[model samples]
Target: MAQDTARQAPPTAPATPARALLPLILPALVVGVGASLLLLLVNGVAERLQDLLWTNLPDALGVGRYSVLWMLVMLTATGVLVGLVVWKVPGHAGPDPATLSLHAVPLPPVVLPGLLLATVLMLAGGPSLGPENPIIVVNVGLALWLGHRLVPGLPGGVWGMLAESATIGALFGTPVAAALVISEALAGRPLKGALWDNVFAPLVAAAAGALTTALVAHPALDLGLPPLGRPDWGDLLAALVIAPVAGLVGLCAVYAFPYVHGGFRRLGHPMLALPAGGLVLGLLAALGGHLTLFKGLAEAAELARNPQGNSAGRLAVLAVVKVAALLVAASSGFRGGRIFPSVFIGVALGLCAHACVPAVDPALGVAAGVLGLLLAITRQAWVSLFTAAVIVASPTVLAVLCIASLPTWLLVTGRPQMQLREDGSPVR
Candidate 1:
């Protein structure tokens, strides 16, 4: 710890000679490579594990109906893992909100391991969360500790640049909107480097991160890139309405979720809570049937590919079932992320919207609605914009989604809202 502090301690000189800078640069590269390797290894192993757990576990359990009882088992275990993480990890599971934005970097290194473990469990188990959150947790966490210990007094701006670049780099396969997100977050703060340096660091880091992710994650990593095309007036107006609706729903989620979930947390025992929530999910599945489990992208995609076969309002029920299950999983403290659930919400929203205007395409509607929610709630314009554009193959669909997203942003921003968390405390 003392050695780390000494490394981070700043010298009186404002600018270190290029020669002096090399030492810091070399170590940073080493750390970057090491972190990248960890990411790859973790991702590859997790993918295989996920498939094994998600696919083979059910059969092994003799749950002949393909019921997601296995998911329940996985979630329950991860729940315990996350509970331990929150207990031992200093910042508590993944990135804090401030750290989530650019203003903050990784948590101090002393507690980074638990966060990494919690993140791994989240993926291996099946929370709706994504690689992005955990990736940031590990990367930024390492960067912050290294910058503090090894590169101290090197200039806060330089550390910030490194952390930010690392984050941007990790999102390589996806339309991470790194440049755009970074630009938006750093709108006010002034970094130490010149314009070129500022841009170059994140670009390189993001490229490296993406490459590393691809090597590890393989076929799973897709940026959802869209072809460039102009959308019409209708698309723009649709976007305006869509964005606000998504925001409203997101706010509702951010709000009502706690009240709804607090009921379960009150149970106070993982043993009781997991079984109880599992029972509830099982019941909902029996009632809602088929829709009560994970959005199961492959399942949703299959349904989309064969829309005509779905009669009996199956899509609608599936949407509601997902909403219920996701809320339960999160509210009950089951370990997982929200993006997977949110994707279902977006898809459901699209299914409904498609019915409204026969003129607007179904695929287009799905793309637009999903992006709308992403924009409204996440405040991540680039991420949502890219997500909306990429999921489908058609250029026309992409154009519509992009145009529609503009209005959705306006709608979400216009609302007055409060966030709801399971702990009964208001989310700041």
Candidate 2:
């Protein structure tokens, strides 16, 4: 009877297999550190080259560093050089960048060098895009290729997740951003274990990456804006209005993306297309001044440092010109990301709001504008929220941002995203 009772009892489900997770820890740490180093290396090289191009060479020639003629020459030349690399380099720089999102298929090893070269050139050449997309692609490709060779038993997805999370952590100088981004991505897929169990390795990687970056560079996102005190009804009102307006402004760029990309494609070759795009960017630089150039990180900080430095008209022009430049850079054959430039646009718009309406807190305006534009441009809810909050670095604004996201999300939810399909149509 005891034996019969034992047989009738349901077999215990296999234990959660917590021991299986132990093997991933070392690899995750290695990938995390490696990801941070690569990001630093790429940015470091680009910064040196940028100094040479913008400062040293211009100084030697006795030309104004950011004069109209110099901006025109430098940007046009940058396009030509980048176009040549794309035209002649093997793998054609790993496909047109417009079709790529943050999470893309791992590229072959052969394609990485050219892609890196193109990305570096774009960074130094004053394109209105950031290092996020291509750098992520490079890190993911390296991680997968090396991980498979080193540990033949693990799934390719594991390496991809590690590299992605690590790179994101490194980019933002905090593991929380990586966690948020990965959590959002994982929410759509089926899982075998508890969510935290599944996230264990990636979180380790992200933390390691964030630590490495912080130790070396001490990166900080806070703009040192005035403190936002406890949230009031007025602050909430400002967030709601500014965020949606920024969303609609960003939507204008989203709607225009396909047409701009299509126009560049009709040029028939990178050689013609990139130079033409550069010329257009030069025109924009002349109108918006030098502050609107580059990936927009330092430029945005500069804008934030003295929000009242520019008149309302000037701020509006800066915002509009930046949006146009970002579109041109992404649409042309340039290899870069959109997030940094979007941040700049949001900052400019936020300042513009404050300039128009003094009742709105500048910090609130900036955070809300960032939230709305990032929502429209990247379509990553958590990332948008995290980025918006970090810029202000105030707990009080979080409540306002959360409430502001509701209306902004509604405006952007059903619309087309900023990315393109393989066929050159906007991804809806």
Candidate 3:
């Protein structure tokens, strides 16, 4: 009888693991599908608008696709359009971008349309921003709204975490990146359970989100640079030195963010502020040319295609112009995220370092350059290292990057961040 009881207990033991995983699996699927659909809807609209701006409208006007005057007209017009949406639409199209972080309380359903409209205009108008923050907000709101009806047992915070994780995973083109980012975020917070217990659901959601995006429309974050050769002592030294320099360059932008945001906020209305900001952006774009426009992904690729082709001075100019553009777009009431453009700036800064020292391994130079800027801009060491490594896809450089980030972290640890506030108080 005892033996029979033991056998019965074994059968129930198998059920425990399955039961434990089912909760995670179900939420992951829901969040993943939701995230993918949202991305497709948002990206699809922006792409069409982009086509109209670049192709149909230019053709209709009988102007070159990149005619300087037409570009200026469209950008200025875009700002006006976005301003109208923000001013007239519901929820004021969410909060001020300058005042928000990568994570925030989920916005309400009423705010989605205006936010979407503002985002579309920003992307099509060639602002130095990306769809990251807006889309994340949208997804998080949608998830919470639906989760209440569909999965009432789940807490609001879980939905928020899952939604953010899924979106970050999809945007960066990898679940692992999202995992690391989330881990860093959850590292010190007091919680009720094991860290993995909380991390499990988010990871599942991230994987599903990444896979779904891959099937529908994949984003490529990889830089595909030439592989690093055998380890070199000289390259190691270069990384240590170059990373801190990159941090200093990024610090210029970080320190300038709030002041720039405050200056634009002084305009006091979207109608006046955004359009004025846009006109200034247009002038800058004209000087920088088309290469300096947009969120910097495509242009970064263009610059990377021939890093050596650009002189150090030109690369320096590109970095400065982009930082200025990012400040303008982010501060002046644009609906977007800073990460993508920051990555581009980091790339430009990295290539600038390579240009100055032709003998430094290109892989090491680029990785270390990115490391410094990301450390200062993001203030997340793990994210900075992973992103730097992903740009070159070289394991050989990882050890050096890890070591280089130490000094960079020290340089940026307690400094002001690139964030703003509604009441004009300091970020802390």
The top-ranked prediction according to TM-score is 2
Q: What overall lDDT goes with each candidate model?
A: 0.57, 0.92, 0.84
The residue-by-residue lDDT of candidate 1 on 70-129, one tens digit each, is 444555655666666755666565432212432333466666676666666655555444
Which window of ten consecutive residues has the lowest lDDT sum in model 3? 10-19
In candidate 2 the C-alpha lDDT for residue 215 amounts to 96
Q: By TM-score, how accurate is candidate 2? A: 0.96
How far out, in Å, is residue 99 in model 2?
0.6
lDDT for 417 (candidate 3): 83
Clashes of 2: 0
| Model 2 residue pairs with clashes | none
TM-score of each: 0.74, 0.96, 0.93
Off by over 4 Å in 1: 1-36, 68-74, 77-105, 172-176, 191-196, 219-243, 261-304, 307-312, 334-336, 355-358, 393-402, 414-428
Q: Any runs in candidate 2 off by more than 4 Å, and if so which?
A: 1-15
TM-score, candidate 1, is 0.74
Could you give the candidate ranking by TM-score, starting with the highest? 2, 3, 1
Quick one: best lDDT, which candidate? 2
* Models ranked on lDDT: 2, 3, 1
lDDT of 1 at 334: 47
